[model samples]
Target: IVGIDAAIFMHPTTWKASGHVDNFNDPMIDNKDSKKRYRVDHLIEEYAAALSAEGKENEAAALLASMETLLAKDDFTGLKKMIDDNKMQCAVSHTCNWTEIRQFNLMFSTEFGTAVSSEEGNNIVYLRPETAQGIFVNFLNVQKTGRLKIPFGIAQIGKAFRNEIVARQFVFRMREFEQMEMQFFVRPGTQKEWYEKWKAKRMQWHESLGMPAAKYRFHDHVKLAHYADAACDIEYEFPIGFKELEGIHSRTDFDLQQHQQYSKKKMQYFDNDLNPETGKPYGNYIPYVIETSIGLDRMFLAVISQAYEEQDLSLPAGEAGTEEKKDSRVVLKLPPVLAPIKLAVLPLTKKDGLPAIAEEIIQACKPHFRCFYEEKDSIGKRYRRMDALGTPYCVTVDHQTKEDQT
Candidate 1:
């Protein structure tokens, strides 16, 4: 019920201790034939998935095994060999001649305090690639200061940056984006139950946004992060295909435990309640974490793409027309609440105060919702334009508006 602006800054060493500084690096490989760089992990994963889909399981398994070795050592040459051995081509460049794999740090680096050069102080700081760390670093502070009970979650929506080598597929994968992340603190033994609960709740959020449940699916991760005991992605059907829109992870106490060990901070919670479940005093224990992370941009894209439609709409007869016919229309069937325009006030004719009436109506409704006033085109044309933009309704102010009502 209460909220405060918490000026919580993360400890720099938290990144180092979490193995973020070391393990957060992406294996990047360039296509020698096309001069395009790509994330090697993503490239190989895509290759494996495609091959498996094509019923080439043996080839995919071999390629995946080789990719694993290549990733472990950051070996570009080995990656190239695997690509050639598996006949895997770069999805972007569509070339098989891939350059050697190299580690690319996705973190955007900056210096704090002084104008120190990389050679001098080398005071390089990273813009967070993920918001989970921020919540992890503040675990003890929020627990003690906020007086939050166990199983309570700290929710945050913040900007995160990842230096993507190939920032394609529109907003689905962006270099800079907003993340709504929540880290739920729970007793160590009960992490699985909470993880499942969050996964269900997160999927419900997507459904609540009006996307069909059939268009969204849960993809359980066979290969989980080092910190994650379990992980799953909420994938939405995009224009291209189904892709990840959000991630739900059971991170356990890996983040807090790592930060505690690295920063020498004691991150522990005590359960005072007599064991209704265990009948024992819950000793000082590192709370396990259930994390739900969602990308706002991805959600926006899913909504936009899902709402976009091109169909033939029925039109009434006009001059010289005998029967009603289908008119080619590109309409965005956007949900009213999310539509860019709520209503448009159109004048059938620009003369005889018709436009004035429209302008007045537009001005009246402008404060309430987005409205468009147009007099340059015919009423039908104006209505079509508004419809194309997904305007929910169009109010035409013609001579009828000026006539006295009985």
Candidate 2:
């Protein structure tokens, strides 16, 4: 619970320093039979999961292992061979005919000026693929201004853009999305410890919202990024399957180092504390970073998937008739803190000062939490409406309220 400063920045140079211009891409493959494109990794994962669900554990393991090996080696030919050997068919086409794999850049770029030209690399600027770079470039500004020390963090929530070749699965994968990220600056050689600490901390935060612990798990990356020394994902079991919901990476001064080199400016921090190895004060050096980046849109989807339910109400006892009515209603059992409507004030009847009393209660609770008022519908109907909206509490003002203080 450290105090951290938040900031937002947008600049073309930030992307250049972060290597998004050169390295932000996904392995894409086309289903020639269906004339459709799909991300290679996602397709493989889905297929493997289906095999596992169908009680083919050995086949699923082998397929996933082969896919991982080929991806690690960056062997596009080998990947295609694996697909062909397994007779993997596109979900849409139901055929094994596929085109060659290729790298597809995800960044969305546009011209900077009105002087439009069809030529490549003509004064181009890009929408940021991630929000971490903005925090990195503004490290010094925040540190100096906020008087922050080592182990401090910078956090932000903002929109990011990516030109996904095949954006599917609702809001889980989209051309534009929101990211909630925090970058912690810690002393070098202590990154491994901080990385583990944040990994556990973030997982706890997710589970605190009443989600079952079994629905979440840690997935360590077999292939690490060039800038990262260690990395893992907090994978959530969504309706489709387990997928990455957040990432925690231990970056060893990579971002600050790159920005220093490209901008020709020093991005070092001086620590007054004594270094154990040298038995002297820790001087100027670039601090290593531990980043925690989560997809805000994906988190929203996770909450909805868990909260939404279609419940069937059992018939009353002793009412054993063939024509007995069966009842059902949709409800959102959202966490109280995240629910849109916290409290609903309903008047049983619109006459005889009941509406006025309900309005008074609504005015009183509105300042404390979100409140909704309704008087047009039946009491049962109003309760059902509030239940659908995930309102945890409701107050009904009726004739009894005028007689008794309760």
- Among these predicted structures, which one has the highest lDDT? 2
**Residues 1-406 of candidate 1: C-alpha lDDT, one tens digit per residue:** 1122222234457668777777777777778877878787777888788888999999888877777665656567777677677777865667688676677777776767766565863565677887778877777777788888787888787788888887888788888998888888899889999999988888887787667889999988766777898999999889777888899999988988888888787888987766677998887889998988899999889988988888866778874289888768788888787888889887888789887887888888989988877778667787778878988888887787899410
lDDT of 1 at 201: 88
Q: Give the worst 10-residue stretch by lDDT in candidate 1.
A: 1-10
TM-score, one value per model: 0.76, 0.90
The CA-based lDDT of model 1 is what? 0.79
Identify the runs in model 2 with alpha carbons over 4 angstroms from their true place. Answer: 1-13, 92-94, 116-122, 276-279, 312-327
- Model 1, runs deviating above 4 Å: 1-11, 32-35, 41-81, 89-102, 115-122, 277-283, 310-329, 340-378, 394-406
The most accurate candidate by TM-score is 2
> lDDT of each prediction vs. the true structure?
0.79, 0.87
